[model samples]
Target: SQQGEEDPQALSIQEGENATMNCSYKTSINNLQWYRQNSGRGLVHLILIRSNEREKHSGRLRVTLDTSKKSSSLLITASRAADTASYFCATRGPPGYSTLTFGKGTMLLVSP
Candidate 1:
């Protein structure tokens, strides 16, 4: 079952602006990952934060996880028009398993 759901189904912003998206899950997870997808392309892994980690960063992306709240948020700084895409959050089950449940995704539009 898919455990994660992202809020703000769609968002629009101008270039150089920042974009933020939040995800909430229903069950415990070993780790949470964020991915990005262009119009019709495959998803690109952005970043992953372990269960014990509170935050992680990569490039212009920043992610924060709160196990107690079963939620996470992804923030993109100084966004660009090229950054327009659909972002999804995925949750992985415990160690012995390799299953991943993905959210419907949040569509972001970064206009120039």
Candidate 2:
């Protein structure tokens, strides 16, 4: 079994600042997705980028993928206190397999 590994295990920032996290995986993937989890809460899906796509964005989020390097990055612009959470990257296995492996996570803290 393979999994994604997130970087910068922890982070701290002030409100209105920006936050960025990176994820790396060992195997080929169908798609890579980002998520946000508040303390003791369920994960919230943020964005998804296919292996063939180089970049994607959703609102304040910017995601980039480099298949050749087997890595991806997530950037949150104008981050707010509410944006403080653990960000993660999930990798979906190829076509038929029903496996979705999640990276450990990058913790982002935004103070008011």
Candidate 3:
């Protein structure tokens, strides 16, 4: 499967703390996207950094791509209670079945 596996299946942090998640894949990919989904809701696109890029950031989120290692990491700074959600990494694979494959995700719980 052209899917990435994320680490720390679950996480809990205080509102003022930061949270970090990691994702690792087995195959080559064209791009990787980060998404956040609230409980029982669809995922919301957070960031997309192409294979050629090394790092990308949006607001309180920072993403890093290391194609050589076939891994990516997401960091959320100064997290708020509202920022609590599941984080997933989807990979855009090459050749057939290029559709994005999602990781199991890391459930983030931000305590107020």
Clashing pairs in 3: none
Candidate 3: lDDT over CA atoms?
0.94
lDDT of 1: 0.96
> Per-residue lDDT of 1-112 in model 1, one digit per residue for the tens?
6699998899999999999999999988999999999998999999999999999989999999999999999999999999999999999988988988999999999999
Per-residue lDDT over 1-112 for candidate 3, one digit per residue giving the tens place of the 0 to 100 score: 5389999999999999999999999888899999999998999999998989999989999999999999999999999999989999999986565699999999999999
Deviation from native of the Cα of residue 68 in model 3, angstroms: 0.9
Q: Which has the higher TM-score value, candidate number 1 or candidate number 2?
A: 1
Q: Over the full model, what C-alpha lDDT does candidate 2 score relative to the true structure?
A: 0.93
Task: Give the candidate order by descending TM-score.
Answer: 1, 2, 3
Per-prediction TM-score: 0.97, 0.96, 0.94
Candidate closest to the true structure, highest TM-score: 1
What is the number of residue pairs that collide in model 2?
0
Indicate the residue-level lDDT of 64 in model 2: 100
